[model samples]
Target chain A: MITVRDLAKHYRVHERAPGMANALRSLFHRKYKTVRAVDGVSFEIGAGERVGFLGPNGAGKTTTLKVLSGLLHPTGGEVRVDGHIPQTRERAFLEKITLVMGQKQQLIWDLPPAETFELNRAIYGVSPADFRETISELTTLLELEELVKKPTRELSLGERMKCELAAALVHRPRVLFLDEPTIGLDVSMQVVIRDFIKRYNERWNATLILTSHYMDDVAALCPRVIVIDKGKLSFDGSLTDLVQRIRPEKRVVLRFDRAVSASEVEMFGKVVERTELSATLQVAQDAVREAVSGALARLPVADLTVESPPLEEVMSELFARSRSEREASA
Target chain B: MRRYARLFAVQVRASALLAMQYRVDFVIDGMLSAFSAGVALIPLFVVFTHRTSIEGWTFGEALVVTGWFTLLQGVLEGAINPSLTTVVDHIRKGTLDFVLLKPADAQFMVSTARFLPWRAMSIVTALGIFVLAFVRLGRLPSLTGVLLSLAMLVAAIALLYSLWILTVSAAFYVVKIDNLTFLFGSIFDFARWPSSLFRGVVGFVFTFILPLALMTTYPAEALLGRLRLSTFLGSLVAAVGFVTFARLVWKSSIRRYTSASS
Candidate 1:
C-alpha cells in the first residue's frame, strides 16, 4: 500500500556556540549544517501487512512516517502512498491514510472528544451513516463510550490516547502510520492499544506501519519489522528472523528448589542472569535442547522454560552492530 | 463550495458547543463582550464631548466609524484571532501535522479551526450603534447606502482576515510573533477614529500601506452615504489582492514546514 524509494529528508539547522559573545556573533554570521534526518531509506509495505518500524532516538523513524503521511515534503526521492504522490497531499490519498502520534494530540482540549470526532467526520466528509457506524464500533472496541463525553483535558493520558486513536480512525483509513502510539501508557494500557491495533488491521485489512519504543507492542502486533538506524534501513524481515540474526541464542530459565551454586549453572551455558532461586542460560539455538537436558540433570531445577532473548536486548545488539559496521567502513 | 459551507457549519457548531461547555464562562464571556463594547465607546464619548466634530465629520457621523470598528473587532477576535492563534500554537507544538493530514484545504481548516461564539455580542452592539447614529442624524440610511455599506462590510472582513493571516504566517518562520500581534492590535485601535484624522505619513500608511481606511473608514463613509464609488472599488480591489497574497504566502510557508519533532 505504501512505496518509498530512496526517500531522504535533510534539514539545514543553524549552529552556534554556548557563550554569549559567540551567540551574538553567530546571529550576525550564521552557519548551517545539513542533517539528514532520513537518508536513502527505501521500503515497501503490502496490503494488509503489519510492519514494525524500529529505530533508536533520532533514527528517522518519525521522519519517515511524516513523509509517508505527507506532513513533511521529502527533500529527495519519490514516495507514494496507495498510488498517489504523498507530497501533493491529494484528498483521495489523505482519505486513505491516518497518522497517530502518541506525543501530539488532535483532540480539542476544552471540548469533549465527541466534538472532535464529529468535527473530523465533517472534515473527512464521511457519510452520516458511515460516521455513526465508525464511532459506535470504535467506542465499543476502545471502551471510549464514557470517555468521549468528557472533556479531553480531563481525560488521563491513556484515555486521551485511546480517544486520539479513535479520532484518527473516524474515516476508516486504509493505511495507518502509527508513530509511537503507546509511548507513555502503562503496561495494561499498552496491551489494550496493541490488541486494538491488531484487531483493526485484521477487521479492515488495513496496512499498518507502527514505530514504538515498547517492543512488546511490536512483538504482539507486527509480525514483520523494518529496522532503520542512522536514517538507513538496517534490517527488514520477520520478527523471528530479526531475533535470530541479532541474538541467535535461546534463554533457558531454571527455577531451583534450593539455592544453587554458580559453578553448577556455568557448566550448562552462559548465564545471562542468576539469583539464589533461578538462573537464565543463553544457549545457541542448536544447543538449547542439550543445555536444557543438562541443566535438568545437573542443576537443582524445579521449573524450566526456553524463550528467545528479550526484544530490547536484540534491538540494542542490532543497533550496536550497525554502529560498529559504519565505523569500520569509515 | 457546498463542502466548504458544510465544514464551516460544523466548525461553528463545535465552537458553540465549546462556548457552552463551561456554563459560567459562557455567561461571563457574553457579559464581558457587552461590557467591552460599552467600554470601547468611552473614548469616542470623551473626544466627542469636547468637540462637535473632528476632521469635518460630526460626532454622530464618527460614531458610524466607531461602530464598524467595534464590529470588525468582533470579527477579529471572534472569527479571525482565535483560529490564527491556534495555528500559531499548532506550529509551535508541532500538532499542525494533524491539520495538514486532513482531506481538506489546510488554509480553510486552519482558518475555521476555532471561533468564540460569545463575541457575537459585539456585532449586536455595532448594530445598536448604527441605529443610535442614524437617530442622532435625524434620518435613516438610504437603501443604496445600506447596500453599499453591506458590501463594504464584506471587504472589511476580508481585509481584516487577510492581514491577520499575514501576521500569523510570520510565526511559521520566526516561531513566535506575539509582539507583532500586539502591535497589530494597538495599531488597529486607531481605526476607531476617521482614517483622515491623521495626515501625512500616518494617513498614507493607513490608507495604502496597511489599508486601515479600507478596513473601517471607507465602510463608515459608505454607511454615511458619502463614500465615492472609486474609493469603494479600490478597497474591494485591495481586499482581493491581500487575500490572494496571503494565500500564496501561506502555501509557500507550509512547504517550509519542517514540522517540529514529534
Candidate 2:
C-alpha cells in the first residue's frame, strides 16, 4: 500500500553562533547548512502489514512518516500511498491514509471530541450513516463513551489520546501512519492503545507503519520491523530476525532458594545479571537447553524460566553496533 | 462546492460550540466588542464636531466610511483574525499536520477554523451607524446605490480576508509573525479615516498597494451615491485579483511548509 524509493528530506537550516558579536554578525552575514533529515532511504509496505519503524532520537523515523503522509515534500525520489503520489496530497490519497502523532493532537481543545469527529466527518465527506457507524465502533473499542462528551482539555492524557485515536479514525482511513502514538502514556494506557491499533488493523486490513521508541508497543503490534539511523536504512526484516541477528542468545533467569554464587551460574552460560537470590544467564540460542539443564542440575534452582533478551536492550545494542560499524567504515 | 458548504457549516458549528464553552469568556468578549465599537466611533464624533465637512465630505458622509470600517472590523476580528492567527500556532507546534492530512482544501479549513460569535456585535453597531448616518442626512440610499454598496461589501470582505491570508502565509517561512501582525493591525488603523486624507505617496500606498480604500471608502462612497460605477467595477476587479494572488501565495507557502519538528 505504500512505496518509498530513495526518499530524502533535507532541510536548509540557518546557522548562528553564540555570543553578542557573532549573533550580530549572523544578522547580516547568515550561514546556511543543509541537514539531511532523511537521505536516500527506501522501503515498501504492503496492504495490511503492520511494520514498526525503529530508531533513536533524530533518526528520521518521524521525517519518513511525514513524507509518507504527505506532510513534508521529499527533497528527492518518489513516494506513493496506495496508488497516488503522497506529496500531491490529492484528496483521495489523503482520504485513504491517517497520521496519528502522540506528541500532537487533532482534538478541538475547548470543545468535545465529538465536535472534531463531526468536523472530520464533514471534511472527509463521509456519509452520515458511515460516520455514525465509525464513531460507534471507535467508542466501543476504546471505551470512549464518556470521554467523547467532555472537553478535551479536561481529560487525562490517556483519555485524551483515546479520543485522539477515535477522532483520527472517523473516516476509516485504510492506511495508518502512527508516529509515537503511545508516547508518555502509562504502561496500561500504552497497552490499551496498542491493542486498539492491532484491532483496527485486523478489522480493516489496514496498512500500518508505526514509529515508536517504546519497544513494547512495536513488539506487541508489529511482526515486521524497519530500522533507520542517521537518515539511512539500517535494518528491515521480521522482529525475530532482527533479534536473532543482533543478539542470537536466550536469557535463562533463575530464582534460587538460597544465595547463588556468580561462578556457579557462569559454568552454564555467560552471566548477564545476578543478585543474591536470582541470576540471569545469556546462553546461545542453540545451546539454551543444555545451559538451562546444566544450571538446573548444578544450582539449587527453585524456579527457572527462559526468555528472550529484553527488546530495549536488544534495540540499543543494535543501534550501538550500527554506529560503531559506520565509524569503522569511515 | 456543495461538500464545502456542508463542511463550512460543520466548522462554524464547532466554532460556535467553542465560543459557548466558557461563559465568562463569551460574556467578556461581548462586552469588549460593544465597548470597542463605541470607542471606534469616538474619533469620528470628535472630528465631525470640530468641522461639519472635510475635503468635500460632510460628517454624515464620512460616518458612512466609519460604518463600513466597523463592518469590516467585524469580519476581520470575528471571521478573519481569529482563524488565521491560529495558523501561526499550528506552524509552531506542528499541529498543522492534522490540517494538511485532511481530505479538504487546506486554505478553507484553516480560514474557517475559528470564529468569535460575540464579535458580530460590531456588525450590528455598523448597521446602527449606517441608519443614523442616513437619517441625519435625511435621505435613504438609492436602489442602485444600495446594490452597489452591497456588492462592494462583499468585495471589501474579500479584500480584507485576502490580505489576512497574505499575512498568514508568511508564517510558513518566518514562523514567528506576532510583531508583523501587530504592524499590520496598526496599519489597518488607517482604514478608520477617509482613504484620501493623506496626500501623495501615502495616499497612493493606502489606495493601491494596501487597498484600504477599496475595503472601506469605496463601499461608503457607493452607499452615499457618490461613487462612480466604473470605479466600483474597478475596485471589484481589484478585490478579486487580490484574492487570486493571495490564493497563489498561500499555495506556495503550503508547498514550502516543512512543518515544525515532530
Candidate 3:
C-alpha cells in the first residue's frame, strides 16, 4: 500500500550563536547547516498491516510520516501511497489517507467536534448515509457520545484526542499515519486509543503506521516494528524479534512467602529488581529452565513466572548500542 | 465545484456556530464597527463643511466612495482578514498539516475556513450611508453605470483577496511575521480618499502599483458615470493579473514548504 524508496528530507537550518552580537551578525550574514531529517530510508508497508516506526528524538519518524501523507515534499527519492505520489497530493490520494498528530488538532476550536466531522464529510464527498454510519460507529467505539457535542476547549486531552481520531476517520481512510497518537494521555486512555486504532485497522484493512514515544502503544497495536536512529534504519522486524535480538534473555520473576534477602536471589542470575517479598532476575534464554528449577529448589518460591525483558529496557539498550556503533564508526 | 461549495457551506455553518458561542463578543464587535465607521465619517463631514468638494468630487460623491470603502472593509474583516494571522499561526504551530491533508484545494480551505460573522454589520451600515448619499444627490445612476460599478466592485474584491493571499503565503517562508496583515491594512487605508488627492509618483503608485486607488475610486467613478473605458478595462486586467500572480506564488510557496516537523 505504501512504498518509500531511498527517501530523504533534508532541512537547511539556520545556525547562530547565543550572544546579541552574533544574533545581530546573523541578521546580515547567516550560517546554515543541512540536517538530514530523513536520509535514504526505505520501507514498504503491506495493506492491512500495522507497523510501528520507532526512534529516539530527531530520528526522522515524524518526517517520514509527513512525507508519506503529502504534508512535506521529500528532498530526494520517491514515495507512493496507494499508487499515487504523495507530494502531488492529488485528491484521490488524500481521500485514501489520514494523518493524525497528537499534539496538533483539526477540530474547530470554539465549535463541537461534530461540526468538524461534518466539514470533513463534505470535503471528502462522503455520502450522508455513509457519514452517518461512520460517525455512529466511531462514536460508539471511541465512547464519544457526550464529548462530541461540547466545545473542544472544554474537553480533556483524552476526550479531545478521541474526537480527533473520529474526525480523522470520518472518511474511513484506507491508510492511517498516526504520529504520537497517544501522547500525553493517561494509561487507560492510551489503551483505549490503542485498542480503537487496532479495531479500525482490522475492520477496514487499513495500512497503519504509528510513531509513538509510549512503547506500550506500539506494543499493543503494531506487530512489526521498524527502528531508526540518526536518520538511518537500524532494525525492522517483529516486536518479539527486536526484543530477542537486543536482550537475548528472559526475566524470571519470583514471589516469596516470606521476606528474602537480595543476596539469595542473586545466585540464580543477574538481579534486575529485588525486594523483601518479590524479586526479578535476568537469566539467559537457554538457561531459563535450569534457573527456574534452581530458584524453585533452593529459594522459597511461592510463585514464579518467566517473561521476556520489558520492551522499554530493550529499546533503550538497542538505542544505546546504535549510538555507540555510530560513534565507533565515526 | 459542487464539492467545494458544499465544503464552504459547512465552513460557514461551523463559523456561525462559533460566532453564536461568543454572543457578547458579537455585541462588542458591532459597537466597535459602528464606532469606527462614525469616526471615519467625521473627517469627511469636517472636510465637506470646509469645502463643497475635494478636487472634482462633490460631497455626496465622496460619501459614496467612503461607503464603498466601508463595505469592502466589512467583507475583508469578516472573511479574508480572519485568515491572515491564522495562516501564520498554522504554519508556525504545524496545524497546517491537517489542511494540506484534506482532499480539497488547500488555498480554498485556508481562505474560507475562518470568518467573523458580526463584522458583516459594517456592510449594512455602509449600505445605509450609500443610500443616504444617493438620496442627497437626488439622481439615480444610469443602468449602464450601475452595471459597470458592480463589475468594478467585484474586480476590486478579487484584487484585494488576491493581494491578501500573496501576503499570507509569504508566511510559509518568513514564519515570524505575525502581523503581516498590518501592512495590508495600512495600504488599504489609502482607499478611503480619492486617488486624485495624491499627485505625481505617489498617485501613480496607488493607482497602478499597489492598486489601492483602483479598489474604491474606480467603482465610485463608475457609479457617478465618470469612469473612462480605458480605466475600466485596466481594472479588469489588474484583477486577473493579481489573482494569477497570487496563485502562482501560493503554489511555489507550497512546493517550498518544509513543514514544521523537521
Candidate 4:
C-alpha cells in the first residue's frame, strides 16, 4: 500500500553562537548547515499490516510519517501511498490517508469534537449514512459517548485523544499514519487506543504506521517493527525477530513465598533482578525450558513466568550497537 | 466548489457557536467596532467642515469612501485577520499537518477555518452610514453606478484576501515572527483615505503595487460616478493578478513546511 524509495528530507537549519557578538554577527551573515532529517530510508507496508516505526530522539521516524502522509515534501526520492504520490496531495490520495499527531490536534478548541467531525465529513464528502455509521462505531469502540458533545478543552487528555482519532477516521481512510497516538495517556488508556487502532486496521484492512516512545504500544499493535537511527534504516522485521537478534535471552520471572538468595536465583541463569518475594533471571532462549523446570523443582517459588527481555532494553542495545558501527565505519 | 461552500458553512456555524460562548465579549466587540467606525469618520467630518469638498469630492462622497473603508475593515477583522493569524499559529505550533492531510484546498481551508460572526456588526454599521450619506447627498446612485460599485467592492475583497495570503505565507520561512499582519494593518490605515489625496510616487505605489487604494477608494469612486472604465478594469486586473500571485506563493511556501515531530 505504501512504497518509499531512497527517501531523504534535508533541512537547511540556521546555526549561530550563543554570545552577543555572534548573535549580532549572525544578523549580518548567517551560517546554515544541512541536517538530513530522513536520509536514504526505504520501506514498504502492505495493506492491512500494522508497522511500528521505532527510533531514538531526532531519528526521523516522524519525518518519514510526515513525508508519507503529504504533510512535508521530501527533499529527495519518492513516496507513494495507495498508488498516488504523497507530495502531490491530490484529493484522492488525501482521502485514502489520515495523519493523527498525538501532540497536535485537529479538533477546534472551545467547540465540541462533533463539529470538527462534521467539518471533516463535509470536506471529505462522506455520505450521511456512512458518516453516521462510522461515528457510531468509533464512539462505541473509543467510548466517546458524551465526550464528543462536551467542548474539547473540557475533556481529559485521553478523552480528547479518543475524539481526535474519531475525527480523523470519519472518512474511513485506508492508510492510518499514527504518530505517538498514545502519548501522555495512562496505561489502560494507552491499551484502549492501541486496541482501537488494531480493530480499525482489521475492520478496514487499513495500512497502519505508528511511531511511539511507549514500546508497549508498539508491541501491542505492530507485529512488524522498523527501526531507524540517524535517518538510516537499521532494522526491519517482526517484533520477536528484533528482540531475538538484539537480546537473545529470555527472562524467567519467579514469584516466591519467602525470601530468596541472589546466588540461588543465579543458579538457573544470570540474575537480572532479585527481591525478598521474587526474582528475575535472564536465561538463553535455548535453556529457557530447562531453566524453568530447574527453578520450579529446586527454588522456593510460588509461581513463575518466562518472557522476553523488555523491548526498551533491546532497542537501546540495538541503537548503541548501530551508533558504534557508524563511528567505526566513519 | 460546492464542497468548499459546505465546508465554509460548517466553519461559520462552528465559529458562531464559539462566539456565542463568549456573549459578553461579542457585545463588547460590536460596541468597539461601532465606536471605531465613528472615530474613523472624525477626520472626514473635520475636513468637510473646513471645506465643502476635498479634491472635488463633496462631504457626502467622502462619507461614502469612509463607509467603504469601515466595511472592508469589518470584513478583514471579522474573517481575514483572524484566519490568517491562526495560520501563523498553526505554522509555529505545527498543527498545519492536519490541514494538509484534509482532502480539500489547503489555502481555502486555512483562509476560512476561523471567523468572528459578531464582526458583521461593522459591515452593518458601515452600510447604514453609506445609506445615510446617500440620503444627505439627496441622490440615489444610477443603476450602472451601483452595479459597477458592487463589482469593484468584490474585486477589492479579492485583492485584500490575496494580500493577506501572501503576507501569512511568510510564516513558513520566518517561523518565529508572531504578527505578520502588522504591515497590512499599516497599509490598510492608509486605504481609509481616498487615493487622490496622495500624489506622485506614493499614490502610484498604493494604486499599482500594493493596490490598497483600489480596495476602498476605487469602489467608492465607482459608486459616486467618478470611476473611469480604464481605472476600473485596471483594479479588476490587479485583483485577479494578486489572487494568482498569492496562490503561487502559498504553493511554494507550503513546500518548505517542516511539520513538528511526534
Provide the lowest-lDDT 10-residue window in model 2 chain A: A260-269
* TM-score for each predicted model, relative to the true structure: 0.97, 0.97, 0.97, 0.95
Q: What order do candidates take by DockQ, descending?
A: 3, 2, 1, 4
Off by over 4 Å in 3: A259-263, B258-261
Model 1 over residues A35-150: C-alpha lDDT tens digits?
98899998888999999999999999999998898888888999988899987888999999999999999999998999999999999999999999999999999999899999
Off by over 4 Å in 2: B259-262
TM-score of chain A of each: 0.98, 0.98, 0.97, 0.96
Predicted complexes: DockQ each: 0.68, 0.73, 0.74, 0.65
lDDT of 2 by residue, B1-262 (tens): 9999998999899888888877899999888988888899898888888888988888888889989988888889999999999989999988988998998899999999999999999999999999999998999999989999999999999998999999999988788999989988999988988887878999999999999999889999999998987899899899999999999999989887844344
Instruction: Give the alpha carbon lDDT tens digit for every residue of B1-262 in model 3.
Output: 7777888888888878888899999899888988887776888898999899888988899988898889899889988888666878898887887888888888898898779988888888898888888888998878898899999989999999999999888888788775677877987987888889988999989988899878889999998889999999999999999999999999888777745455
Mark the 10 consecutive residues where model 1 chain B has the least summed lDDT: B253-262
Candidate 3 — which pairs collide?
none
State each model's CA lDDT, in order. 0.91, 0.90, 0.89, 0.89
lDDT of 4 at B33: 92
Fraction of native contacts in model 4?
Answer: 0.81
